[model samples]
Target: MFKGLCRLTSVAALVCSTFSTALGAESGKQVYTGTLGKTPIVLEVNADGGGDVGGRYFYQKYRKDLMLSGKKVGQTLVLDEVPLRGDQDAPHPTIRLQPKPDGWSGEWRSPEGKVLKVDLQQANIAPAPAATVPFLTTLRDQSPYEYLRLQGLDLKKGKAETFMGYSLQWWIEPKSETTLFEVVSGYTAAERQRINQQLMGRLWQEVAGKFDCEASAGETFYAQTVEPLWMGPSTISVSIATEYSCGGAYTDENDMPLNLDVKTGKTLTLEDVLWLGQGKPLHYEREYNDATPSSESYDAYSDYRTKTLAPWLVQQLSALYPDEMKTTTEREDGCIYGDEQPWTYPSWYFTKSGIKLVPSFPHISSMCRDTAFSVLPYNLIQQHPGSAALQLP
Candidate 1:
């Protein structure tokens, strides 16, 4: 289940403020979840003493969050979307919902000028299963030093006939009392929002684009950010991993590491994490296991595999596991040890103690081997050349 926060205004406050004479009530917020024209949605409404209304509307289908603001004019409640940055030119949808005895009914207008009849009944607010609901979890909490939150969104289409799906789980740090912490948190939030838009737009274009595939042959895409790593006073880091299968022979997996300077909101690259000399750092492009001959030459791929990253990684791994490497390398099919194969970017994350490296499946050995993780302690890293640049304690 996804866990996150949904800060809503109390229904009592809304009633008393919007219809004080008709229904006397107290103040606060309420959340309602249901469907809007077959799309699952969540609405949070807040009411103030002056009859001002403000809250959030979550379009679960696309995992879009729209800020809402409106007021009760006579017996009608009107709400409109407050767009985010770079969205000013886009049409702003509006909701004209009227309160009913059991729930609310309204009409929703799309930016494209399409209209949909909305029928929403009040229901108990409960966490939906992640497998089914687009956004199943939300969290809003604070610690002495920092506050943390998470939100999850999933989309599934053509499921009845084929199987196309996309999912995103992310963290949201709305505010922080610390200046540097707040800046870095805002940067991360903005980056996540940008990625969400790109991914969603890509998925739609792929599924409905000119080269659309048959519904019987759909694909699946999934991505999620792991638990964040926040320890040092000046650094914060997280990893986002993705897996996709488009009726291919093998599913593809990749990861993006997000390391940030807590003071400047600047992203830290892999080189920043590792102490590299003036020469180029270890880098290699992957060759898919099911690559076609029209792709780049195999010799170039092999050269990168054996000459660049493989040798360096081998030396490090040997230093860390000398005894195991001696016996393991003697065996046939013994860990391709960096050979021509479908390559995935190694996944890495930072911790207070060390930097952890997660080798993808088949990267260290064969598919039979359990995924292996290697940790280079901070002390070891400090011993490397130019390590002083890291300024680690």
Candidate 2:
């Protein structure tokens, strides 16, 4: 399952192109909007003078970037499209443009010798993506990618779902769909409203990131799903799985779990549920929940994660699932579930049986992630509750 470690999951630019837009500066970069024939396109060009010109362009409909790199000849720019696969020697499309009265007029020639008219004019940058939800950037900072992707989309509502007697309505948008649910019966009316707002905000982040990544790479792969793992008088917990390729070397996936307090609707963190810290656990900053602590405090927290918490998890899970704890070979692609190395930086969620620990591994061993072999029983939580006053079943 895919989750947003909030690993600050980044969407990088491929070649000659980046996730940058024109915003009140002449940083050698300019954004243009026009048409490659009948197809509308957004183009960025950097003419910083060295006779070198580079940028990215995407069809407005597709929203996937096509890298551009070439040279400026007199009054014209001759930009060759770089292969998305990074094969410089491979055949690609080419664009030649000269300054016009309004913007730039160009011709795009395909490798197959087909030619098309390319007309581009300066694009007026729109306001940041505040349309989905108010203060949408609270969960994570907005990027040029977000603005570029969201500016054109008109989100519509999809079907609603009733799960375990709970009503959840789908707020539909692409490159994915998400839901919003109010805890009418489990929590107080006011608290439920607040909790629903928080849930919707988080869902917006997940869905928005999906669209952002999707737009970044025209051929980008993206999918997301949220499953209610456990919903009770204690808390409502859901597992969000996101699998996407956002202009990276390879595709990525993660499982970000959301656990909420029934009474307060407060989103529960690992530190809130199970802290092995000496005194104060990872501090939750003012607004951003994914925000990290300073170096000194973070060093201590790292010690607790790697040295204290991870090893204990190894022991606890080993006693329960001995077979799963073993790793074969990197070549064999065996997931080492018991390896305390990954458990240190805990990725956990509330499960029906217990608190399930999801381990993260490097690219080669990424198959080792989300194995779900390690779950600490709820009875253990009853015995050793963290600083949180909430009760768990």
Best by TM-score: 2
Error of 2 at 375 (Å): 2.4
Residue 184 C-alpha lDDT in model 2: 42
Cα lDDT computed for each candidate against the true fold = 0.44, 0.66
lDDT (Cα, 0-100) at 138 in candidate 1 = 14
lDDT of 1 by residue, 268-314 (tens): 54445664344544323221112244334555544654455445655
Show model 2 residue runs off by greater than 4 Å: 1-34, 45-54, 71-78, 85-91, 96-141, 154-159, 174-221, 243-253, 261-267, 283-300, 318-335, 361-373, 382-389
* Model 2 C-alpha lDDT per residue in residues 247-350, reported as the tens digit of each score: 77787777777777777767777777887667666744223334556788767766777788889888888788777776555325567665788887766777
Displacement of residue 182 (Cα, Å) in model 1 is 9.8
**Given candidate 1, what's the lDDT at residue 56?**
65
Q: Pick the candidate with the highest lDDT.
A: 2
Give candidates' CA RMSD values in order.
Answer: 18.1, 7.6
Scored by Cα lDDT, where does model 1 land? 0.44
Assess every candidate by TM-score.
0.37, 0.68
